[model samples]
Target: MKKYIFLIILMGFTTMGLAQNSVSGTIKNRNNETISNVEISVSDAVIQTKSNEKGQFEIKNLPIGKWILIFKKDKFEIKSEQVSIGNQEQKILDIILENEEHHIDEILVSSVFNKTQNENVVKIDHINLKQIQNAGAINLSDALATNPGVSVVSTGVSIGKPVIRGLSGNRVLTYAQGIRLENQQFGEEHGLGLNANGQESVEIIKGPASLLYGSDAMGGVLYFNPEKYAANNKTELAVNQVVNSNTQGSNSSVTVKASEEKFKFLVQNNYTTHADYKTPNGETVVNTRFIEKDFKIGTSFATSRYVADFRYNYNDLNLGLPEEEIEDSRFRTPLFPSQKIENHLLSFNQKVFFKNSKLEATAGYVFNDRKELESIDEIALFMKLKTFNYNVRYYLPDFGKFETIIGFQGMNQENRNFGEERLIPNAKIADIGFFGTSQYKFNKNLLQFGVRYDFRNVTIQEFGEFGTEGSFQKLDKNFESINASFGFKTEITEKITTRINVATGFRAPNLSELSSNGVHEGSNRYEIGNPNLKNEQNFQVDLNVDYNAEHFDFFANGFYNNINNYIFISPNGNTIDDNFVYDYLQNNAVLFGGETGIHLHLHEIDWLHMTSSYEIVIGQLNNNSSLPLLPANQWKNNFRANFDVSKNIKNSFIFLQANYTFNQNNISQFETKTNDYLLLSSGIGTDIQMNKSKFNLYLTATNLLNKEYVAHLSRLKADGIYNMGRNIVLGVNFDL
Candidate 1:
């Protein structure tokens, strides 16, 4: 495993060069004056310091234990505190600063039953980083398809994927910095090859988390949270640009960061290109062009009780495939039933602090390379997936209000195939998991529970030409699972809040559903696989409600799962080279969903704002049919206003949005029936500055009335195409 990830990153930089912890502080305000250059940081270490000019500040090789001390300056009000350090320690503190008016509600760590509670019971959905830089989305499932029971299942515009609530791909599960993202996601045209530039937020867990991430999370989990550095003796630089106009596309990125208090680093690079999109009756669509290149790097080190992190990512893709092209140029090249993907990822994380418990370790590696081509010098399917993952967690020392966690996770996978069609063979996979979770707090409620156990093994290596059903002779498989969960959160009055949860999940049947036999060139069918498919089992129940106030905000969520064998594919009336033959079946299923939202914030027009959301889902089966790539029934709305035309422009806004969708006729069995749409979008933005740099423009449009649609999780909607229409994006971002 790459020399065991380089001997655990050289023993965490040789224990950060013989540790020596330190933390010192002094910032003031609230009329106590003395706040000098502020900016002090230390959460997830990489240290940082500033305060100077008599406001003192010090940060030296820290890592002993709990930490979170952040305080910025410029108009103040970004404060944080939670400190602890020991062993060769030097600690001193005092800080206070508060002035940046309102807007603070963010802190969610993918809640596996409360990470210091910010409301939980398993309903986490956030997407910050300024809403992904004001949604100029071109990836990360198009910025997570604008939240709310998410959806996206494209096969164009750079291949998308992500559809929670009515499953998708390998049953959804993606976690970036905290590992668990093995690339070849059981292909429905792949694509989630990680790159949403150095994200600093995105957390979602809609249902079933398999007792905290095990076995494809049974349709949920998307976490990605990385990007943090540059706060103390900072150094940062940034540049971004994007433009699209219905896929004449473009995107560019660059970022750099540096920090010191105990080392920190970040670097990012991105490049994307697009073409061949257009369709609002204006045709184009041929080949559905795409191209991308991404790069990332991260580093960290600390010392109070040790902390370490390291990350690396590299991706390259060139996908184009919308067969039967009628060529209307704008080519970004990939021609001939194309696809070429390359991904590499590495991760290392560590932490150890014990005074009240804490120990975490993570290791990951993934290298996926897939290729498919049909004509330009034929290749046809080339798969290569290698994954090695590990995780360990412990935090059991808080017995005042009770809290505990224990974990272990594992994976080692391999899949190989080289060209000339081989749908699935050459495989070796192993996984292990063990878990325990707990949390408790009385008074205002909060209670949670957990248990998990899992084990899987798959081994296959056989070739064709012997008694042929595409021959597959050598195979071994074993799967075991057990899962559980329970949760509750309260505070039912003072502006209401509630949550409830129950969970259980599992999935084990992927090697293309246990060893497929032939032809599956990305859904042209002719597949077959089902080594007695069993082990799908899932169960879920969730409910949530909230009602914060200051100027309104509401939410609601609901869920129901239930799966049991559930693994589908269908179509057995036969047809061969001409495609159509499918198999892999198992039944019993059910899915139900809900989401609701409201935001408001008018209070006598304080810069007008409004919001709305709605969603629904229903998957069925146990003979009641319906459930094949489902997703429809949605609603969204927005209004927004907020302005400030002067002071060099400052955070302005203007919005208007509406989305509708609804009309899917619940399909299954060869599915067909789409129809309904309703788009409309708008945008505007601001933030200028000029003397010390800070730009950030924006402009958006998107289908504004050019409507001709087609989306019901469009995998090109079974070949009737039509989905991209009016676009118009434009973006800019700066800081140097």
Candidate 2:
């Protein structure tokens, strides 16, 4: 594989590139008024340019094919136009944009059809780069947890599990570089191995996406889009640096990219290290430090009828488990009882364009090595997971108002243990799924539906001596399911839009859930697996409504999920070796919740913006007992202002945010209640231009009031550990 990647890179560099195609356009507003400084970009390509003072823009050196041109600017409704680059040397176009009432919608590629939010039947949230930076999130999980209906289950400040609604651990799926991320996600201590540096943006499918991504997507999907290559016939070098006050941490990265008319290449390297985090009482949390190193490379080649993309990423991480002891000295390296993980991912994607149809295929491989250390030289637990996955899709020709797609997805996986301690047996897994989906549009209504069939097989090998603490039973299980989804979107009026979606999803038991027979060190409990556990299946209904006016926008969303044979772990009222014994069980469950928000842009004070949102979720079993690991209800508010300090400084903003988590009293039998708490945050950022170069500077402060509290979903809560307090971050980014 490494040799192949090198060969591809060599081919890309040696091939002579073509630069004949070109596109030129002019922008105008509703009254035929010229609009200047409008950003223009071509979809699936790195070509970009801005309209000049005369509202005229030209982008050169383009591949011959059909492309979508996107136009975006402040206070304007984002627009897209389809353009074809044939044998012609240059293509000219004129565009008109309408004034936006609220926020602009971005084009989404994660969805089957590349459409804007207002044009799709499903409700998808787009998180842009600005949002991620303004939030001052140190990791990907922390950035995701800010969205509604999304929460994080954290182990210290390093490892975190993303929970959608009330389901986590294997139920929620994450996709990066056009492939599923497989990193032993069945364990709660496992975190997202991918970094945020090379990502363009994140798209969240807040409901059942199994119809599109197959099994393990029963909860939802987080799609991380990779950054685009450099503009045609251009080379760019960029640097980013960040510093944190509380942990005395520093994060730095460097990126280099170049592109020709037919070939492109990009590379990035990032490193981050942090000392133990401090609490409100001015005491540092013991062994709460971590270090990460990541490297990414991407290359692509394009022609009139064919396009290929290749991406590879490597990550190395070392994290410490928080202990009760408080350390006064600063230590960047982890102590004993720490975790070391390494991940490597490689993906290849290709697309062939026909007269009116297209074929797309993607193949990926993931290698994950995880280890827990008992001392400087002794390894307590070690596991290796390898996965190979592939996907192929055919886009049928659009007929009138109907469009369709057919696809096949499959994967083969293997897991093994290399340490004396065994949490689960060695296992082999296989999966195959086929799906077909269609969309129809007429007048003001859009309808979408899909169906999928999936098969999964799990095989486990017995391990350890008989009648021993680490003994496991041999088992073979096969699970099959047929899932379907339906969605309808309608424009109620010029200012109102509504969406309704119904979907069914399923998940087969993981290896640990089916074969574990020993103590789980993470939770410090003896867990016995149930071989007879059945597949967990669920049906969900979702409804969303949005109202947009001159200066105000409001949205409301609700969902209800009914699950059968839901799997959970509970104490069996027994103890072994002074450790509590827990057994995996199955029961019917239901989860229901809703999220609502309002955004107001003052009509008179155009610079001021205020937004507020509330989110809640409830999960219960057939016996009316609450499910464990559910996040408490939360309410958040933000006030922001935007202005320009001078001509050299543009897109300046400052904001203040407040989050209030309500008390969680509806606890499961094995859990305890949590008290309510409020947190405050603030940030300011601006863009500075010097000659032909641009720089972005920002400062963010989290836990502004130094509030000391523990989140309900925190794994350290059992140890009476509080979250981090009063941290300020300073960031600088520049490109040349």
lDDT by residue for model 1 (323-356), tens: 7745555467767777889999898888777666
Off by over 4 Å in 2: 1-23, 29-38, 44-67, 84-91, 98-101, 325-330
Worst 10 residues of 2 by lDDT: 9-18
- Backbone collisions counted per model: 8, 0
True-structure RMSD, every candidate:
23.3, 3.3
- CA lDDT, every prediction? 0.79, 0.85
Report the lDDT of model 1 for residue 30. 87
Please state the error at residue 533 of candidate 2 in Å.
1.5
How many residue-pair clashes does candidate 1 contain? 8
